[model samples]
Target: MSVSVMAATAASTTVGTPWINITIFGAFVAITLVVVLRASRNNKTAADYYAAGRSFTGPQNGTAIAGDYLSAASFLGICGAIAINGYDGFLYSIGFLVAWLVALLLVAELMRNTGKFTMADVLSFRLKQGPVRVAAATTTLAVCFFYLLAQMAGAGGLVSLLLGINDKVGQSLVVAVVGAIMVLYVLVGGMKGTTWVQIIKAVLLIAGAFVMTIWVLAIHGFNFSTLLGAAAEAGGAAVLNPGLQYGLTDLSRLDFISLALALVLGTAGLPHVLMRFYTVPTAREARRSVVWAIWLIGLFYLFTLVLGYGAGALIGADRIKAAPGGVNSAAPLLAFELGGPVLLGIISAVAFATILAVVAGLTITAAASFSHDVYASVIKKGKAAPGSEVKVARITVVVIGIFAILGGIGVQGQNVAFLVALAFAVAASANLPTILYSLFWRRFSTRGALWSMYGGLGSAIILIAFSPVVSGTETSMIQGVDFHWFPLSNPGIISIPLGFLLGWLGTITSRTLENPAVAAEMEVRSLTGHGAEGATDH
Candidate 1:
């Protein structure tokens, strides 16, 4: 049968059940509760809440970094891409893992040496407060929104697939439970507690992925060649080489390149991932931790390819294509099919944990930007009492959590990969340039940072909101209206360049207004691990 016919049939059959998902979700909440309660007690200081008092060790921080970086997109989207598109799906994993090189060499150590709570502090280190705050908050919120959407959408899909619940209830529950846990972590456990939660989740996800990989490989007697051949036979060679089927079309190539740029470059710019580096006590430890993270991330991704292809071979792409969720159902359905009900339950639970850990990281990072940068700095002129900043940060966490849940519940029918790519493009466009300029360019000024943030962010949003991928006005007040501002769905190609250009222009315009004293202090602090070195800069 053709792939389309198989997919149509899969959507009609309720092949797998959802009870195991609910049971595992309960356990996730319980464990998270214990961690939150423990972390809350020691979060009396801003440093503790914001940077985990900068006390985490390498391995611990490494796992947490993995936890922060590995979102539902990596788990579900990549798997589906591979099952549906073959090697092109695996390309996402390669690009994602490769971006760490930039982070490790360019960002990891420097971020630790520069900012206190958020990336805004680093970008605004030498600039004026208002512009810095606005830019930082904008970048933080943009990335968080898209990232949260992907996670929430994934949650809805997972719940629907595993427990047989509708998308609305499944997504809302994920947001509610995840939001609550994240608020608790920020409010109660603070950074220390949140780091632990990430570590635990990362371990579970990797272990779970490995178990599934091994089970699948064993079922085929550990022969990778045979596995690929089987998958190809079942799904056709095009599934292994998406280019074979779609490469001839310019539109398809553009889509592939857009997604690749977002996945590769965006990883270094994600606030949640960057925030984790600050939790380490020293810049050196932060660098070392990334090494561990790279290894862990690479291993996990390598295994996912096996899992995806193995699922294609064993569970049969036809079976997955016939499922309601199409390619997205490949992972769980294969889990249930190959490992039976017990393994199926475990896979569902692990998937839920992946979403929870990822969303919690994104929510906390956004909250930190609001509380530490916007509230503590802008609203109070940096005079908000010692613990007031942390208090405000916690409150902001709760507020952001409510919004994330609402947003997740709202964007229900969107494609999971598309949602994730939007976050990446926005991150690369708005945040990356400002951050790079702040770190490397001595001439970078407050105006330059602000313009880059707003310009890149604005351009990307305008383009994406109107892009054919988002389906701009068909669902709006007007009926039978359709428009696509951009032919290609992804905007990283243009948005990322816009950011770099804006930063350059802003720097040239504001050269004379740059603060020499603050710039010198920031330079020293960013180069060295002395938060105390640039105390006067703030």
Candidate 2:
């Protein structure tokens, strides 16, 4: 039988038999709950609640970072993109991998050496605390909320597809349940619980991807060239090169560049990813963890190529499109075709765990931003007790979780990768410039940081709201609406530069004198780690 006919037949047969998948998913959830419960026992102090007591080793922290960073976008969305768009889809993988270089070299050590609980801590170190904290907290919340929504949406779609719950209400219920669980992970387990969940999920995800890659390679006689040839024949010769999905014209090329810039810089600015640095004991460990993460992430992206091409070669693009959730279903369907119901169940369970882990991380970071940065520093004037701060963080977790559930339900039919890309754009545009200037530049005042954060954030939101992503296109989130005036969907190319320029302009225009003592102190501590926070034991 031909690939398309075979995939169609398989789909027809697999519609109602989701018992194995449900059981596997149940098992994963149970294990996660147990891990969280145990981790909660150690999360008594604010330090423990926020940074896992700074106990994770470099390798362990690296694995957890991988889990936190590799959302459904990396596992399901990227695979789907490659399965559908061929070589064009793999571009995202490259961009994501290259992003680690920026994190490793530019941000990781400085973040570890300087920050306490949130990215706001780092940015507000040498600058005035109140305004900078508020700005950082706002940007942090924005990035976390958008990223959380994408993960939650992916969870709902995966649940509906894998468990055969097709109704919109059913999917929304699933999203709510996932959101509730994520809240519990942060509220009870805190950073320690979330980190453990991420570590376990990372292991399972990497193992699942490795198995699938090995299976696909074996089927193709261990010859990558043969596999690519098959994918080319299945998806057409265009599948072997770029421009099938992007980079077709001057405007499209600009859009692609915007996307690449966002992905490359966003990792360094993500609040959740930055929070991971504090989970390690020393700046050296932070550096080592990034190295480990780079290796693991790079390997996983390589395996995604196998999974994507295998899906195209074996299942064909048409069936993948016709599948529920479109390209998002590519990895799961490929799992089913290659390894039967058992493997499908395993992969589906892992994907679900992926969503849960990412959501948990995002929630904690959002909570930390709210409680530590906003509530404690801004509202309470930094007089809030550690225990009270932890309580506030728990409350914030519930609030953020509720919002994420609602947002996820609202964005159910959208593309996971596209949503994630928008989150990246926001992070790159709003957070990256502020972080860079605060860390490196002596004249980076509170005004400059605020302008960078608010300018980049406002520009991104306004552009996206008026861009083709909102309307004026068939793939837009809002159809039958043509109010869009901006041409490009991704706003990083314009917004990122605007952020940096606004920072510069604000600094030169402001009369705020550069504090030489504060600058020297921050420089000395950031480079030598002389006054960094110490790790606490349970």
Candidate 3:
């Protein structure tokens, strides 16, 4: 009754056509459109557009945060990795789950109490608004750009595979449709619509995973050891070990550590994730939301472990490798093999919803950075009309969505999980240091914040551009060219230290002028929520 035994017995069964998947996916799209239309009715002010008027209860915001954090990269990419690399793929899940501890303990309440709408609000609270806002906005866009590239590429591949379209034109069309829908979500529903979408997706995603895991276990007579043993047999003995994919040699070990560092530290710096804290009504609510998010996210990842190992056990690595996107198609194929067309269609729809919800969240955060942080705070000196700011945010969403479509089409076939790791590296290098110093160091100055943001941002981009991922490897975009100069694909180890060093250098070398009064006020507000944004119902 093990999945492998079942797969062997049922190998000759005919699978259903792509039209079933299309029908399910279309239904999801229709539901999302209705959600956005309903949410748009209340998006009249800046607060409503950017922070959902700070009215979400703790549990609601927590589910939204889970939806935002568990992107296509997490649901599909991580599962794919596990199907291919076995135990090594589970390492990414562990890193991601552990990072939430940092967010829950250090950042959740602090960010909620100090910031109004964006990460810039917290960083610029005790620093110079103009320079700090500019630097923070720059980093936010940078993180979102790389993150969107990965999600959109995954979106295109998923759409193409599920719809049985094998051509580049078909993939491009899928990206366009996804981009347009994401734009609609942000421009019309704003945070309220996006949050609801995320909540619904999170529920569906978790429920889907739970059902799949139970089905997998039932096939194995509810024996965990039987499942693990079968997976090892299908994937070979190396699949159960650490060095199969990421941790082979000295250099690879260093790279693995660097990737772990980025994943652990980067969550705290992610602007979209940080912005979720502001949607709740109070600092206490924000704290509770993080706890709720931690539980939900942890449960989902546990289910992912079962899905991954079961896929490897049931689908076989050779067959998974021969699929369209190789291991990326493992989970979908497993669903087909297990429950035929119906479960496959459901899983495909969930994957599509995952991409849409994540991209919408990223779009809103990037738009908020441009409008709330840069336009309203920097260009207008905080005097921009609320209506005008919201209008600018809507326009920015369209622009960002268009750019993401082009980028996704351009980077098709790339490993989405790798690209996501790069995005995390940039966030860790550029944003985390600035956030930590801005919150903790009394001597942290505007000059330090700027150097931390720019230095980290510059180093991450430069290193990634020269790394083997771009050109040296067979899996790279331009595989024939070998112009890679950077040894490690992830730049976290070097760039993170450099960010801290530059911040210290800038602070000590610059003028000794310090704003003790503002620091004191920020500290008081962050701890007590005395002057933080209030709930809309209040």
Candidate 4:
């Protein structure tokens, strides 16, 4: 068949019924509600709500980490990428795994040792709380909102495609469902509930992907080479090699680099992920949790490669493009094709689980930052008791959920993968450098940390606003906004460095004013996890 005819034929295949999808999705929601309700009783204390009461063991924490990290971008986006873009898409898996290594080796233990709740807790180790809190909260809210937008967008796309709803309606529904479940989880179940939900989701996602991978290969005559050859023949050279779509050369290469930076550096900086470390009681447990998380992440990402390539070979690019919602539908669509109706139904349920699980995690994290960092620490000066803190967190979860739904409904047509990358760039730029320097750099002062956070945050936001994806500009948004200002789609290339530069300059300019006695106590607390109160210079 001619490629055009093959594409048309592939596009015309009927998917499963909308009612079937909605029924399955409804069941998933019921399960989450039950879990959240059961967990909420234990969430009375702020520690319980914000950090799961520091109760999870290493392995449980590891699973939750996997659940938290494996967002829609990993499941839907990567598979779609693989189906449409070929092996180049698998590169994301590599970048994510490499990033965890940094997390495990560098930040995990230190974060657990120093900070009580948010990234700001760590950066404010020696600084006056006022400037650090303001900067940290600004970065946290911005990062969470940007990241939530992508997840919300993904949830909308997933629901719309699977259930055949209008995109805006689908997004709104997704936002509401996710927001409700997460609010309950944080309000009732708190940290413990969120952790378990994450663990369960990780297991479901891995099992579902494994089942789909097997079916995909079986349909391809169980031959790996045949799969690649078929994918190549089907997609042409663009699919076979790392072509322009993979961003291997020139402009595309820059885009690729930006994505890599976001995935690698951004993981460590995310408030949600950092907060998970605090859930572990001790620094050693935190370290072990990350070690296991890296392995799980590696294994799951590996399966995505098969799912992506398998879809490419069996389902074809034309069909994926013509899918209800572009390439994001490739995995589910492929499931139906390979395993027929039963498998389609099962995979549809799994996809719903993926969305709910990811959204729950994101909402809880955002809530924690709002309540713990902004509300309790900055506004109340950490005066609230653990019980009151938990109550506040629950309320914030509901409020944040509403905002997420609104944002999700508003940006229904946006590319979630692109949004996720922007989140990463912002986190890496605004949060990571400050935390790292504060922990290890003795010369770093309050002024230095404050300046770094502001500089990084400003650069990332400005760069992203002008980015092609957000600005709707025809120019390579990074390249077109005047090369003199920003040169990459992701701002880590510029913003991260700028953060460090500002911090260094701020410290040097104010070296005489630096307080030695306060610095020593901050160092001890940050490195030892000894003092939760009275370390504040605020």
Per-residue error at 451 for model 2, in Å?
Answer: 0.5
Model 3 per-residue lDDT tens digits across residues 1-538: 5776556434422234778878988898889879978987888888898899898999999999999998887888888889888888998899999999999888899999989899999999888888889999999999999999999988887777776665678878988988887787778889999999999999999999899999999998999889889999888988888898787888989999899999999899999999999999898889989999999999999988889899999888766654555556777878888898889888888988888899999999999999998998888987897599988998999999999999888777776777898899999999999898888888899899999899999999999989987879887767689998999988998998898898888888879656898888778888898988632110
- Comparing candidate 3 with candidate 4, which one achieves the higher lDDT? 3
Residues forming the 10-long window of minimal summed lDDT in candidate 4: 475-484
List the candidate 1 regions with Cα displacement exceeding 4 Å.
1-17, 166-186, 242-246, 316-326, 413-415, 472-481, 531-536
* lDDT tens readout by residue for model 4, 147-188: 887777677676666665544455577667655655555556
TM-scores, one per candidate: 0.92, 0.96, 0.95, 0.91
Candidate 3 lowest-lDDT run of ten = 7-16
Among these predicted structures, which one has the highest TM-score? 2
The ten-residue window of minimal lDDT in model 2 covers: 8-17
Quote the RMSD, in angstroms, for model 2. 2.7
Q: Give the TM-score ranking, best first.
A: 2, 3, 1, 4
Q: Per-residue lDDT for 254 in model 2?
A: 94
Whole-model Cα lDDT of every candidate shown, in order? 0.77, 0.87, 0.86, 0.74
- How many clashing pairs in candidate 2? 0
Q: What is candidate 4's CA lDDT for residue 422?
A: 84
- Which scores greater on lDDT, model 1 or model 4? 1
